[model samples]
Every structure is written in C-alpha cells, then in structure tokens.
Target chain A: MIQRSQLDLRKFVAPEFICGHGALQLAGRYARNFGMRHVLLVTDPGVRAAGWTDAVGESLTEAGISFTIFDAISVNPRSRQVMSGTEVYRAEECNGIVAVGGGSPMDCAKGIGIASSNMRDILAFEGVDRVPVPAPPLICIPTTAGSSADVSQFAIITDDVRKRKIAIISKTLVPDISLLDPEPLTTMSPELTVDTGMDALSHAIEAYVSNASSPMTDVHALEAIRLISSALPAAVREPHNLDLRFSTLLGSLHAGLAFSNASLGAVHAMAHSLGAACDLAHGRCNAMLLEHVIAANYEAAPDRYDQVGAILGAAEGGRGTPAENVAAFRRSLGVTETLAAVGVREDAIRTLARQAYADPCMVTNPRRLTCEDLERIYAYAL
Target chain B: MHMHSDPPDDRDALREKIIGLGETSLHKSYYPELQSRLAELERFRALLDQTHDAIFLIRADTGRLADVNASAVTYLGLSKEELLAMPFASLIAPHQKAAFLETVRKSNEVPSGSRRTCTAYLVSREGREIPMEITVRSVIFGDEQYIVAIARDITDRILTEEELKIKESALESSTNGILIADLTGAIMYANPGFASIFGYEQDGVFMGKNLEAFFATPSVGEEITGHLLDNHTIVKETIGLRSDGSSFHIQVSGSVVQNDAGEPLCIMLIVMDITERILTDQMKRKTYEQLGKNIEQFAIIGDHIRNPLQVIVGYVEMIDDPLAEKILEQSCRINEFVTQLDRGWVESANVRQFLRKHGDGGEPPLQTFIHIGATKEEDP
Candidate 1:
C-alpha cells in the first residue's frame, strides 16, 4: 500500500449534475442542448404512475423535442428489456435518451444505448471498460434517493438466461446530464426510503475503506456518510419533507461519485448475487450485508472504519467498533432482516458465495476473500 | 429441563403474510392510454417504402414474408401480393438458402435490435441472378417478432471497384518512370520505374522526398511548377540527377491533377531517360560536319596543286627537252590522279567497294599513288 504522502497518481471522473427541488424539469432542455431531435424516454410503470414520467414528457414537448415512451423495464432489469428498448429506440429514430426512474430504468436505458451504439447484445458488455463506445446523450432524472444511476458510471443488468446480475462498468455509461429532483422522493414508501438510505450509507462506508480509495474519494465518501447519517431517519419518517429528501439525494449523489471512482468492496460484491438469485430489492440486500463486510475488513483499515464509526455517532475511542455502531444504526432504521428472514435458503449459500467471489467488486475489497471465506460470511449473515 | 415441545405455528402465519404481499405486488395489468401521441409512427411506412433499397419484413417463426415495400416488389419483379405470399427462402438462391435461414435463426436468438450483414445472390422472378448485400435486424412489434431485411444491389459497385484495381495494377507495372508530387514539390508516390531510373532499389525509399532532389537543379522543379500552375502541360528534355549524384538527359512530361472542385491537388510527372538517344544523335551530327569539312579542305588543296602543276608543265613544254617532256607527262598524270580522287569520293558509296574499283591488285595500289601525289615515278 502506498502512503498518502507517497501516492503519485490519481484519476477522478464524474458526470455533469444538478441537485435541487425541481431540477427534473431541466431534463428536456439538456436533451435539446445535446442535439436530441427525438428521444426515448425510459421509465418503469411505478414512476409513470407517480406522475414524474408525465411531467418529464411535458417538459420535452414544451422544449420542442419529440419522444417515445419505453416503460417495460422491471426491477432487476433483464437483458431482454434492454434489447427491447434498443429496438424501440431505433424504430423511433431517437437521437438521445431520457431516463426517469430508479436504477432499473436508468440501467435499462444505459444498456439500450450501449447495445445500439456497439451493435452487440447487452450481455456482451460486462465488467470494466468492456463497452467500446459511448452511449447516446442520456439525461437522467432520478426519482429514488439511492441507486444513483443518474450520475454513476455503473450499470447493473440482470441476465435472465444466466440468472445473475452482471455489472457493466465504464466511464462511457455515465449520463451526459443528471437532473436530481427531490419532489419525486416523496412517493417512496417508508420501507423503501430506509432501505435505499442504508444503501447509500453502504456505498459511502465501503468506498471509504476500499483498497482503491484516495484522498479525492475520501472527502466525498465522508460527506455522504455524514449527510445520510443525519438526514436519512428524518426523511424516512416524514416522506413528504422536501428538505430531508434533498439532503438524502445529495448524500446519494456524493456516494455515487465516490464509489464510481474509488470502487466498492465485499458488500456490493455479495449483495449482487443475493439480489439476482432471490430477486430482492438491491438496497435491502446491501443493507443486510454491509455490517458483516465491515466486520471482516475493519482490521485492514481501522482508521477509516473508526472515522465512519465517529460519523455514525459512536464516541471517540469507544468500546464498540465502527462495525457495531453501523449495526446499531441499521437497527434504529428498522431494517434488521437476516438472509433467512428474506426467504434465502441455506442450501443456496455455497452457490451465492461462488458468484460473489467472482464478482468484479471483490477485486477492490480491502481484505482478500476466498470462496470459502465468503461462504462463511454468508453463514454468519444467516 | 422438562419443557414441553412447542409446535412451530409461526410458519403458517409467516407464509400467509408473504403470500398476501406477493399477491399485491405481483399483479400487473396493461392499460393503454387514450392519448393520440404515437400517431406520428404512421409516416415511417411511407419513409421505408420510399427508400431505394428493398425492405422486407419476415415472420421469425414461419420464415415467410409478412410485408414488403414498393422497392422490394420492383426489385423482385413480382406483384406485392405475390411477393408477400411467397416464402422468403424462395427469393434466395437455392445453395444459399440454408445459410440465410441459419443467419435468420441466429438473429432471432440474439437480442432484438442486433443486426447481421451477408453478401448473397437474390434470384429474380425470371431467374436472373443479382448480387445483393443484405442487412437483417431483429425487431419486436405488437407482441410478434420479425426479421427486417434491407437489401441493396452491389453489381455496379463491385464492377467499379474491379475497374479501379485494374487501373492501379497498370500504373504499378508501367515501364516509364511515374511520380506524383504535391504542389509544394514533396513526392507523395513513386512507382518502381521511378525508383529504378533514380538508382534506388525500392519506391518506398524515394517517397516523401522532395521532387527537386531528383532534378539536376532546383530551378527545373520551379519551372515545371510554374507551367503547371498556368495549366500548361509540357514535355521537355532536361538533366536528371540519379541517387548516386550522376546527371543524365531525361524527357519529362508533366500535368497538374485536380479534384472535382477544380482545385489543383498534385502534379503528375512522367520521366524517360534519353541519354543514349541524345548521345547517338550528337555522334551522327559530328560525323556529318567532319565529312563536310574534309571535302571542303580536299577541294582547296586540289585547286592549289593544279595551279602550280600547270605552271611547271607549261614551262617544261616550252623548253622542248625529252626529260622535260617526261616531267610534263608525270605532272599531268599527278593532276589526273588528284582529279580522280576528288570525283571518286561519293557520300553514299561503300568504302570497300570504292577501294576495289580504284586500287590495283599489286604491291602498289592506285589509292596509295593518289595519296603520294604521283601516278608513276615517272618514265623519266
């Protein structure tokens, strides 16, 4: 490991972003500036029913940009949906894309753009730097506070044939513009709010303690942890409060920018397998798995974990470690669900362990993990 | 610890709760909006049909044509109804139909919007074979899967490409030195003939060199550029410098090449080595001039000798002595020999034939006597 003073090289990448109460209205204007004559507007049915999709469409029409709707994307978006979206994009002659939902719609949009531009199946692009071309101009208006697909360089797409979520990481997948508006966050249920908020917390903590972390990512990760710790409970309790929603949105955005450059650790790697195999909410999986990963990795980076513990309101030099403090925080949010509680079978632990061990995120984990070690961790989580 | 075993009653309660949640979450029904937003798509049909390339939509499951554009109808030489009723495989050549169907199957298996291109021959209604480039894309519309093919005739394009290849081959094999240089005199291309003429083993060694480097003087390149700028194509003989720094006579014919916009792009120069021809011409001219001078000198010498000989002959005849008569006879014979020498020299006659006609077949020959200015040593 290079000491901070001896570190000589670092690179950071982030998308052009805006965060405010009604920045979602700027999606169409940004699309026009990107030279979009016609666009494919990707969203899920839930976001469509929440009225954000219609609002985004009105903005596009007012800006004199024609668009087509592709709302067939589902949670844990399948590769088939991405291909179908690409077909619609070509049929409509869309010059750009506007995604108006959570991670599923945005990831589906990214997959569509990648497949269309590269002229290959979406599954062909898995892992880092595999996408050969930049996606068409994409403007994202994220409705959920977590899963910052609006500004992230990551696209998690599920391969229905393989029954696993493949993470495609490339700077080209970063949206051309991100329009974050807290108005849409009011529609999320309290359970969803807690789950997604905890996902953001996992993103911050894991990025801060990752082997690839640097000073540039450290600041954003810590700031995200501070904001999520302070504002997530309030936002979950009072869903309609715009201020708390904005804070959580900013926190998620910072966490995304941090992990995008610094990368994540075992928490994300393990959560991906669980999310894909069980078809569960991704944030809930990450929340359930974050504390255990930290417990396993705290010995490798004690100072960074201690800082995270302090941010979560643990006393300085306290008897409890940061991993315990984070667990306490998860309990306070009422998200203490075990793997068995979520209907995961003990027989599947070995398979999930092997998949998580092979995930790309495992490479950046602070402590090296073997397949056996991952299986043990899964048992511990159970 | 004598505790009574309690039955696991919570399993049924938990199962009921999960089933309730799953029922509420899993139920989905499609509701089509009554809005008239997607009506703009009707224009796509006309646009697709208006294209020059043939477009056909085939059902993936049946491998039959579901729809075809006007261009497809015209290209296939069949009516729209007939074309749509025919199987897509019937239009493909019999030998290529299997491969085409396999490609269509693979396209169906791949994700929608993935495309594949193939070069195949399409059989027309009259059994005429037309080479075609076909692009097939998988599409899903209204719950049905289709393979849309756009085919273009590539006969003219292939012919043009072949013609270009022939021309390029001819240029490469030409014996005359050929060079193409930019306006700034930098050599862009040099053929093998140019390399050999310039004493290089390969054309690549001469590329990017200045055109002036191959000229005996830099001013020659400038003069050629000046003529080219005036749109004057010229052929001129000039000195050429070889790679070894030896100079030789060369004939250069140069013209300016231009683009469709009428802007000059480069200068094309054809060079021919004319050193041997120039040397032969110079030798012939020198021989002719020397023969003329020799004839003029011979005439002058003959006139001077005859004038003196006549004076001597006249004086000897006046004296009327035997020896003096002999002298007069000999002088007359000498004068005859000199006159014969002048008259016998014909430009067209072979020297050996002239010798045989004039010389004796003995120790002393007639041509030898003429050279000594004596016919006989004189009966005196």
Candidate 2:
C-alpha cells in the first residue's frame, strides 16, 4: 500500500459481435448488419479446401448479401498480395471485407483496407497504432482455431522487398465481428492444429506476465492460459472433437483480447525473427523458443516465477527454487533441448539474436537483455 | 480501721481495670482471621494489575475507560491517564470504529457473563498500531455497570496471517492451471487459472463439474487420474477438453497434496499446454516418415542405375588389368561391351527434374500450400 495510490486502468475491447460455435451459419446476417451492399471474401487455399469458402458464399447468397471471393492469399501474406486484393476490392466495388481464414488473409484484408482508403505502401503503417483510418468494415470468420487476429487490432504482413515481417497494430484494425465456427476448425490438419494451438498458448503466457499487464488483462490471460493448456493438446489429437475445438476457439479469443492490450514478450520477438529468416511455422518456432526465453526471464523476477510455479501447481512450499520451477515447466510442456534439432544452425545464431533484439515485442520484456545475452540464449537454445 | 478504708478504695479501682483488660483480650482473639482475609484480597488485586495482558475498567455512566493496567499502556501505546480519559471507540482503527461502537451498544443488553470478544487493532500513544484480542464484560463496580476489557498484542501473529493471505492470493491468480484433487479425482482446490482452463468460474458454485469435465478422452483421463491416485505422482503431456467442446493438449505433472495424517488428501496437477511442441513433434514425425519413403525410393532408383554401371566397370577393369596374355586377348571384346553398356545406360536414363534439382546448384522447392485449378485458363 504505497501512499502514491497508483490507479490501475482496465480496458476490455472484444469484437462487437461474437457468434462462437455455429456462428458461420449466420455470416450473411452479420455481414448485412455491417451495412455493406457488397462484401469481399478474402481467404487462403487451405480455408477453401476446408469448404468454408463455399459455405460463406452460400450463406451470403441465401441472405441476398452480395459477395465476391478473393482466394490468392498464402500462409504468409505479402505486400504484393494485398495490392492485388485491393485491386479486386476496387474492381468488384466491394464495400466491406470478410477475411475468412487464419491471420494471413485477415492481415492482408487490413493491408488492403489501408492501401485502398489511405496509402500506396502497406509498410508505411508498420508499427503500433500507426494506421489513421478505420479499415473497411471487416468481419473475420476464422477457419483455424489459432491466431486471434479476428478480434485483434494487429495485422502482420510480409515485406518481400526486405524479406521481413511487418506488424501493423492499429486500434482501427479491429474487426466488426468475429465468427468462430468449430465446423471449419475441425478440418485443420494435425500439424496445423498443433502449431496454431501453441501459438494461442504463447499468446496467453506472454500476456499473463507482460510488463503492461493489468488486473483485467491478467484475468483474461490467466483464463486463456488455463483453457488453452487444458484443451489444446486434446484439440490437436482429435480435431473433429467439437467440444475441444470449441474450448480452444474461445480460449484463443480471450487470449487475443488479452495480448492485444497487454502485449507480448521475447518469445514472440524471437519467433518473428525466425519467421522472417527461416520461414518456419510461427507456432512451431514459438514452441521451440519458449523455454529458453522463460529461462532468461527467470532471473528478472524469481518471486513472480515462484508464484507462477505455485499457481501452475508445479511448486509446493517445501520445493526447490525458481530454477526448478522453470525446468519443471519445460519438462511438462515436453519441449526438447535445442534449436539445432529444429534445423537452425550455429552460424545463424548471431544474426537471429540481433534481429530478435530489434523486434518490438522485446520492448516490454521484464528483463533488459543485451545483444550478447540474446546471442548466448540462441547458443543455449541450439 | 484506717488500713481497711484504703484497701476498699483500691479494690474498687482494681476491679474496673480488670474488666477493661478482659474486653481487649476478646478483640485480640479474632485478629488473625481478619488478617488472613485481607491478605487474600491484596493478592488478587496484585495479580490483576501485574498481568501481561491489558486490563480495562470501564464506567457504566460513560462507557469509557476508567482505569487500565500497566500492560494496556504498553500494548495500546497510551498512557494510563489518556486511556482512562478516552472512550473505548477511540482505540479502534478508523474503518472498524463504527463496528466496534455498534457491538458495544449491543453488549449493553447482553448479560455480563455473555459479553463477547473479537480481534481488533488498537491505536497507541505513539500513533503506532498493534492488533489485539480483547474481551469485555459487564460488571457491577461500586453500584455502576462497568465493563472490564482484557487485551493482548497480536502484531506478530497478524503479520503471519497477512503473509498467508498474500500467498493464497498469489496461488489463486497464477497463470498456470493448478488443481489439488483427491485420489478419486475429486477436486479439493483449484486456482483461478485452473478453473478457467476447464471453463469453470474460479469461484463457481457448481458441483459435478470437477476434473472429469476437462478430459477430452474420458478413458485417458480416467487412466491418468487413476495413475496419479495410485502412484502419488504422474507427469505426462496429454489432452483436455473444455466445456465449450474445444480441446486442449497439455503436459500435466502431478504430485500428491498430502495431509498431516500422511494420507493423500489431494493430488496437485500442474498442466501446461504443449500443443505447440506436440504439433511440431507430429510434423517432425510426418516429415521423417516422408523423408524415409523418399530415401527408400531413391535407393531403388540408385540400384537400377548402379547395377549395369557396375557390370560395365567390371568389364573395363578386365581390359585395364588383364591377368595374363590370354586374358589380355579378351580386352577388345570387353571394350566393346563397356562402350555399348555406357551408351545404353546414359541414353535410357532420363534427367528427372527431382534428381536434377538435388544434384544441380538449385535447392529443393519448399513445400507450400497452393490452390489447385486456381489459375485462369489463358487462350492461345
């Protein structure tokens, strides 16, 4: 109880509309609610394979909401793709965008909105709260159970020119509605399920302990952690399990809300670097790097780690210190020893570490790590 | 005659003195019993004044402190005079002052023996604070309804209590899913994180929605839960399902939460969602399998090319290293066989792009998701 009386400000901003389980069935109605005469459906091929594209198209057609499909987006959305999407938006005279996939298509849609309404280059809005105008009323229907991009105000686009991933975090980028239909998520391949599920876990953990965390964020973050931790593995092993898939979807949504406000830490920082340099799966890279970053963060606040350990039920009163807790945590996650096993080479460690240090996510890390320390972490990871 | 007159007067005076002496003797006989009774009263008074705990004598007229013992001054940090002048309500913490005053008002109706006590913080002379356990009673002292309060310092004890509370809160708000359950999988305690994981409110008042609700595959859950029960410890990466029908894959490490009796009151489960690592592991396994199949297919292709090439090499070796003059005479035929075989092998083997890509400077094209039939058909 300090006399200074630090007032804690709390905020919760979710998508205005959340139709969780069978939400996609009402896609047209929701799209119409946005008052768009013509809707542009932006998605990737994998989503098309899952047959969600046709369902969305049919729903819109049945409801008499006019729509055009743009399915050129890939796993990592590119500036060229956004430009092309913008062209499609203009040619079709599509008044709104319904991004119906994981993060990439939605991110591209946001980029398209930026390019169409305001700017020539997508990279110009490549940081926090940079985009000035609200994106064209976008409704996000996530076909995957990961990447809370639908509700998040952030968009990540790849810059082929620089061979780097650019993040556009603008409050105006938030979607008008997020429809998480478990039907589409059940089609996720086991690998996709695992990768995306890990991404959600990373989001939850990072937000739960972020420097900018508030009690409100902490509540959501902790809930996300609990639900994701309990449900992700099951979802991965049995994608068709409606119960598990639904829980994960809800959990991921909460996690997205949390991290959007609280932000993330070094795991994301390092993962972004890996995504840029190696083009590895973001979730896989995060999982690979999570423990090492946890170990590094251990020294910053051992007491917090102990509390976290106790909360995880990994530590008892008579148990060992924070080091033991961290080790136990990694072991529990079933994470392996090094980045070497993940095809990352020793020679690339220095470059990756330097890039990781430059990542925006590193700003809120509890520990102020030096370039040398990050390099050592990369070496240890290897 | 004169001796008789003096003796009579002396006799009369001696009788009056003797009567007074008898009266004094009777008073002296009862003195020891009175002395013993006075000694007992003084001893009781000393015991009350010298006690370690605070003793308060309250006035019925004003409900204020009439007198406080030496210990009261030390415990409450108030001088005897100040304590005697101040109302009991003044000693209470600001937040609790009204509550204490209300309780005192209610105690007025209650009988003296039925007077109650509670834990409270008392203010001191130096403005320092100390928590105390105080007992008050209604007593008749000199025809007034006076209250006696006995209080003791509990500062250290209160600090310990505060520490425990902080620890409990920390555990409750932890980010990790923590569950302390019995061997029967009946949950004894769950942190807010744990409750949220299974899609239950941290303070949800619902029963029958325990650890069983989280297991996506009930059979696996039962197996692991049973294992933890029997073994007192189990740690594994497994899957859980939430109430909303979504699943989570987690790594669970559990240990026995035991009671003082040494019997397991509960098992604490520390669950981590390793869905990311598991997915990567699955990917690695799939890739390894794919790599194996590719390698084996390449081996068959290798043998087909190597067999004829090896025969041609055998023939060439005979021409290059002939054993004798007779063997050397066969060199021309060997030369013809080698040249024909080399030409046939080279001509028949097509330059497969898969092999060429690996052998040439170009790297293998990375696997990416591409939509089939997505490209528009261009007219010639």
Model 2 lDDT per residue over A1-382, tens place = 0111126665656665454566787677766655567888998888888789889988888778899889898777888899999999989987778888887888898899878777467888888877776666787898776688988877878788887777777788877777787778898887777678778867877776677677777787777766766777677678789999888888788888888887888888888877777787777777777767777887775554555555444322335554454344444445544578777898998888887788778876767878887888778777
lDDT of 1 at A183: 96
Q: Score every model by TM-score.
A: 0.53, 0.47
Local accuracy of candidate 1 as per-residue lDDT tens digits, A65-148: 999999999899999999999999999998789999998999999999999989899999999999887787888998898888
For model 2, the stretches where C-alpha displacement exceeds 4 angstroms are A1-6, A307-337, B1-380
Interface RMSD of each: 16.0, 52.3
Question: Chain A TM-score for model 2, please?
Answer: 0.91
Model 1 residue A149 CA deviation (Å) reads: 1.1
**lDDT by residue for model 1 (B1-380), tens:** 56558855777765744653221222221111211223344567788788989999999888789999888888889998998888888999999988988888888889999999898789998998888899999999999999999999999999998999998787789888999988888899988988888899888987788878988997898888878879658798999999899999999999999899989999999999989878866665465446545655666687778889989988997896879978978998998887676556432224533543453222222343244333222312
Per-residue lDDT over B53-93 for candidate 2, one digit per residue giving the tens place of the 0 to 100 score: 88888786787888877788777666788887888878888
Cα deviation of B128, candidate 1, in Å: 4.5
Relative to the true structure, candidate 1 has a C-alpha RMSD (angstroms) of 26.9
TM-score of 2: 0.47
